[model samples]
Target: MRLTALALLLALPALRADEGMWTFDNIPVQKIKAKYGVALEPSWLKNLQLATVRFPNGTGAFVSRDGLVVTNHHVGRDAIAQMSTAAADLVRDGFTAATRAQEIKVPGLELMMLVSMEDVTAKVNGAVKPGATDQEALTARRNALADLRKADEAKTGLTCEPVTLYQGGEYWLYRYRKFTDVRLAAAPELQVAAFGGDPDNYTYPRHNLDFALFRVYEDGKPYRPDAILPFSAKGASMGELTFISGHPGTTYRQQTHAQMAYARETGIPFQLRAIERQKQALLALSATSPEARRLAAEAIYSLENGHKRLSGQLLGLSKPENLAKVAEAEAALKAAVAKDPALQARVGGSWDRVAQAVARQKALLAEATYLDTGRATLVGRVAALRHAIALVRLADETAKPSAERLSEFSEGNLKATRAQLLSPRPVHKAIDQALLAAGLEEARQALGDGHPFVKAVLGGRTPEAVAKAAVEGTKLDDAAVRRQLAEGGKAVLDASADPMIRLAKAIDPFSRAIRKQMEAEVTGVFNEQGGRIAEARFKVFGKALYPDATFTLRLGYGPVATYANGTGTLAQPFTTYMGMFDRHLGWGGNAAAAEGGVWTLPQRWLDRQVKLDLATPFNFIYACDTVGGNSGSPVVNVKGEFVGINFDSVYEGQGGYYVYDADTKRAVATDVRAILEALRKIMDAGHLADEALGK
Candidate 1:
């Protein structure tokens, strides 16, 4: 989806003062069902499975009765990238299956379904009450939930996930069954799939034919999924009931206004800056080294997502309408609570405390760029060695087969470092320097000033010097490093006197501690805020917020058109192939833009001009609420048939995590027909196309 004027339109004025407040519990699901004439039965709801894809970080839907899954091409890019080699650049050239046998299988990836949900609010609240301190409350809540999870796991055959919803406003135990045998069915070329590229990402009038097909396989056969919905060409009708079932990662909707302010003032800015720095590093490394290029691709992906999301959050906050809505909501909530003395007393000064925290962290947050720390260098190598050591130790202590341990350790280490080494740029002098510096600092922190390795690395010389030497002195080429590690594996263990090797040995624990501290701080905030919201919401709104996602099947439905911002100007929900060419021409100067040269067409455009495929009919627009985990969700028509794959939303949609706007709000999805046609015609993957189309 292209980020366009549609974003501005979705910014509707706050709900009228007279309109009764509504929560998720009061969402009138039955009313929506009656209005759309769609069945709201649990059976129908259960048919929608949340399709979770990890690489590009998104979700999808399973649409065929025969285990055929539909998701966005971007979502599956990671798996495809993993399987690609220089000789076979799947990402650049694209992948196709001439026959069913040619289909590529993605290992260690799974599609999951939530089997059931049990509201555990009463039990959870019983353990921790309103008067407890944050730590006390957190511990109580954790213990309760832990017990609940174990009990639920025993009761349900599925994996039990105890979730504190609305932060800690409520609790629900969710049961899920995960399926691992997922295979790549088909995908379109870069031209059609990523039609408008980043310039048009998350916007309407979007020409992006961003869709892909995958299938769930089990026991050497395609899994006969019970929840698959059939596809229909005629999209969802106006005002028809539609449900989007996918994994929605997280939302800060229940956050206090102070929390929102904190995220805007502190979190978002820091993330954006960090992403920019990482992007710079990755780009430089990619330009200089082929190994860095491949290895950095994954890092680049992570950074891009962070960049896009943070950018979206910032942009979303910048919109006058969005700011107004948030202000109004907070005001209304505050006023209502003030009228209730009990509520006012309960939440007294909490918002102020949160605000103070934000203020305190503001400067540090801004400076907290991930790249400034110089931690990435020896971190991977150190982690690899530690894992190897752990495996060796475990093998020595346990009855487990030595061969199995060796294989597992070797594979684990290889997988961990594969992306780093394979990156387009590989490790460069700058990155190496930063990494070594970070590693040495980490070693000093972990092993203290007296540690032999730390002393050798830090003895009068700086990390910069050590890094320069490491890069310039040794035959530390990627292949050479791998070979040396493989051949001299036990030699390092035998030589306790080697200061350089010992320093290398201490790298892992130091890096791990650094990462652990950062993670702990982040998680602590998330959990604390989550708990607060969950508790307050339960006290105020009651069962309004739904349970946390258990990778369960769900159905979210809205409409298939652009949102009306105000004044009759509708952000047209769809874009055509012509727009692709226009965008390409507009961004001709950028190398990234030039890579989209396939869209700059005269013959292909003319030949395919009249095709409805070119007209972008199947790419429907919706104010349907979604999040990162909601990737690959099937945008269905009123008939509950698949229309497109929901992939992205505009930068302004980040705040949609809390409040949804029927106006400027738009979700970017790929039309199923376009996907099928692209695979069949452009990519020549006819067999896979037939399967995807249910032929």
Candidate 2:
């Protein structure tokens, strides 16, 4: 009498041309072949998958047999900044290694190459007993996943983690061959790499080099990988089918209406405001002197990018019709489940439960967010505070069983945790003080001075005074001290008289309590109920729909096709090097005044312009589905050859977090030809060019 769930799924609308951040294991081979008429073979997929590498924040790929890795300049900016000093500003002058000995190892940098993956959905889901409470189900799943991670690492000696996709619909254990001995090979000046600066960040029709080179090493020698993307002489052509191989960060396209609502109201605003505060603090610090600006360079750039991106996402969420569309789809899903008694039993209360979780999240958001344990909040940005939180949490989390510890402190993650905690990266006290003071002011504003956290942190003193004391008095900046405290554990931490440590100790109780409550109430419920919702979707849609992104490896395919620019004019898919010169001139820039400001072009580029092939493509736009973490993702043709490096998406495409509109959404990438051209002629880095071309 009624249509089956499978039938309903089949009858629903077909998938769009470019719409998924698909897992490497579940690439839509048939859909890709049918849409673009390019058949992808297993060998090609495997080779590309092996070549692609994941950074902590972005993606990259090996271009030569000698492990010459390529990624965005912004993605590699931290390494460049860290390698810099008051006497040597690498960000301004750029760097090129003439020989292997010249390359410098970047501190605290790790590159993960995905070696293998195995779906463990059944193992994870089966751990939860039927009719168990959300918290119980959550704990069981975590413990189960943690055990799997531990066992896998023990067996293979590779870094391993259980990746949850489709919310909790599927769980896969990804094993990665980790590389920590990463060295910077070559990079262009910031003026060229970030040519147009913040004004042109997420826009198309741009000119930006935005590329950096790094080499992976093993035992103090270059480590060659099994797979590398051969550089294409002719990059992507108009209407050419292309693919992006990278680890896209989180996407909320499949989230429930209640979850989206919470993000729209509380989550996005809080994050956006926090970014604003950080930007202000960094800007003020930068205004002090040249050295201060240099110290604040990496942080300021990061904050500006984050602020712009969050603003775009918030704008998309603020659209009523967007939420209404989500609501309507949710209603249809509810109606579908209502007709099946078994399905109803499994997923009927999922929506209500998620709403309840959202309520709990709202209640805890301010405290949990403001008093974070070094996971990227205003308060957590202080190096000393972050280190203190790590020590505090480590003391507690490490004491618990491996399965019961917090995710960061778990056995599988301990190596990376320790590496980051004890890194010798220099900490700028001025920047730290500014950020901490701003964070405290924000806490006071958000949680009120009467709030226990604010009162305890401020201690009747001004935020500036407290921040100054903590930053100036802390010994956490010394890597040896961090190691000593970390190795000595709780006893050493308790005995420490460092002001930052003392402050961290005072706030540890409230922070830990809030985090625990959040885990049990908000996160636990979401995982349980969200898994049920995913299960219900699986019953209907099967695996035809891709999971939400979780900052894991994925392959998204599209074409280098033009789109109407919302005004009747078709946007050009490619911009040539000549256009770059024209745009520079249009912005009132010239070779003589190269150091003017944001629109400044590096002097080397102007000096070598005549030697360059001005007709070569500089930047191009494609309908590829990409987001923040997709920056530096290797853009390949159907033949699996490296063509361009994905860097940014147009502002219209910011809605991509919620929906994929193939019509208007476009990803901007720097053409490999441009990169090679500049390398050979402008920067005089012929050796790097030869290596990239696999000569």
Candidate 3:
């Protein structure tokens, strides 16, 4: 009991207080009871787990028995954009289906709910010897995990995902039921749903109603769900215990200082610059026409969101407090390992090995960012380079025996891959060509004017000309054309005449080689050495610490609380509808609105204001830990009563992905009362509101 004595001696409040994004199976029962004097029953835990669903991009919660899921408006934006048109722009005006028949089916929209979980650490680690090279161990682990997943899927007919927890210190086989037929039910206008723009995002005392509704359908009818979160008419109160249930995407809490520095310097900065450039390109394109504006709206939103998120993340990372905390945690981990003779012998030098790999990877990052990750600005993310790689990889991987290919191309993921590759999404040639050129140019700049890939991509042609040749020459816009090539395999790729196909074929060898190199140098070392560090941590902190987020179901509990609102200002925990209107008018560009820009309330909402209670809660702040993927999570009380819907974390909480600062970090959510009020008063969504409230 390395940690037991330290736990008692230090009496650390971080471990005791409401913290951690805990897996459903690993709830801190004693801690919860101690903090709130409330007990969570087994049945309640199961129900809560079932109620939460993982949308492709974010989290959602079941609000009705017929599988009506509520998620952030941003999460559902893609579906909405796809369903919208120039005439009936569902995204701009917002939409509310008066009847089930009127609800529009969103093609390729998918969600997943965790059905069961089983520990599989032993099976995964079974193949590796006590001591082995990082690459050997990683290759064995990946192959084993894939084989296990394939077997489980074949046996249970469920989506079997092998989740590596604590950076592979633990592993679990989580089975999920996938829902592909999701339909848009009701959504508010874009203007109101995202009431405040980028400036308001990640801010507290917010009034935005950032929520949307979708329904899961099976066999042409609404699916009856076994679990649902019942919404309360009354909102949450200050200092009350709060819980957030959702699928948080990713966190790098256990990364060493060197790795974090790489992110802070090369990775994050490069991404921010890329996003800013993309934002400008999108805006410039969207200004061409009203329809162009409509189609590019979601892209613009994504760009802005990314820009703000990365900026905030950098701010958090730069903070002395966060840096000091990381150093302290790293020091403690090292000390813990040194105290245990066996562990010290096993992992004492793991960190140095990781540092060497990090240094190597840092040099490759710029090229990797462009060619491998396809983050290159000139070629853009969705251009010919990726499309080419997909075709080549598909051909190469599918040529191998089903079990030999990577998990991404394995038998278990074919359906998902096909759905994405062959989905009938609209395309704007101008946007495509522009972004493609940007990515290509970025490749040239990062790699060099004389780089082989750049030369091949350019093919002695101008970047714009090459881009036009690729976009206009490729038949990938047609799903059937893509399917034919994908099914044709390597021989077909070799024989193909399509410009994009030929380009992919030419670059495939180089890209594949780099990928292989990356698999060994960076990913392998990080996972192999990171697992050792995690073991060291477990020795010191034991099971008291929670694993990092991995885009899975988790719950983080804290208190509904207030904090300093920056510059010695005391911020309130909650905001009301009255404050919303007051701020709107104050900042609505009238004579009194010296703060700038106009914000208008809908005429319907304005007319109904007299009949409604302006005092109703609009948004609230809580101490729950959250990150980007936690959007649309259900914010509830200890008894599992819905109080709000999570959409953003306060600026201070940007560090939440790496550290939880109880003093300043807070989760910002739209009050359930606000959603209900808007539905009943503004949107005339009375029936839907009644159903959510069980009234």
Give the winner by TM-score: 2
Ranking of all predicted structures according to TM-score, beginning with the best and ending with the worst: 2, 3, 1
User: 1-695 in candidate 1: lDDT tens per residue?
Assistant: 34563554454222111111122233445656565555555444444433322222566666666677777777777776666777776765666666657778875565556666788878977987676655455556666766677666666656666666555666777666766777776766555666655555555556676677777788888777666556664544433334565666666665666667667666777556545654665577677767567655655665677677767767666666765776787676666667777767765445555555455445433122221122232344333222333322332323443223322233222332333322232233444444455555544554567755466556767755665555554333344453444444454444433333344444434433443443334434455555553545566666544544323333455665555434356555555544565566676623444654534433443355454355535355665666676678776654556767777776556656555555455566665665655555566666655654567
lDDT of 2 at 26: 90
Single out the weakest 10-residue window by summed lDDT for candidate 3.
8-17
**lDDT per residue (tens digit) for residues 1-695 in model 2:** 25685564443222223888989889999988786678899999999999999987899999999989999998998888889888988888888888989999987788999999999989988888988887778777777787788888899999887898888888889999999899999999998899888887777778899999999999988998999997898888876788999988989988899999988888888888888888988899889999999989889888888878877787777878788889998998899899999999889999998999999999988788876563447556788788888888788889998777777788766765787889877777888899999988888898898998888888899889999999999989888998999999888888989998888887778777787788788888888788889888888878898888898999998878666556555567799889888878877785444444667777777888899889999999887888889999999987788999999988777877886667656788999999999888877688988888878
Looking at candidate 1, the ten consecutive residues that score lowest on lDDT are: 14-23
Tens digits of per-residue lDDT for model 3 on 1-695?
87895664343223322568999888998888987787988898898899999987899999888878899888898889889889998877788988888888987677898999988888988978777788878877877777788788899999878899998798888999999889999998776677777778878778887899999999999999998888988778877788899988899887887787777777788889888777777788788999888877788888888788888778878787887888888887788788889999989999898889998898787766666633344444564456666777787787687656755677656555566676665555667776777666667777887888777767778777887887888887676787788787777778888887776766666666666677789888998989888888877788888899999899888877766658565566788889878877777533443322325555556667786789888888888888889999999886677889999888866766666677656788889998998888777788889888877
In model 1, what is the error at residue 120, expressed in angstroms? Answer: 2.9
Residue runs of model 1 more than 4 Å from their true location after superposition: 1-27, 34-39, 49-56, 126-132, 150-157, 236-241, 289-295, 319-328, 334-345, 356-534, 545-555, 563-569, 577-618
Q: In model 3, state the lDDT of residue 471.
A: 82
C-alpha TM-score for every candidate: 0.73, 0.95, 0.93
| Candidate 3 runs further than 4 Å off | 1-17, 129-131, 373-380, 383-387, 401-404, 411-416, 424-428, 589-598
Better of 2 and 3 by lDDT: 2
Per lDDT, the best of the predicted structures is 2
Error of 1 at 316 (Å): 2.3
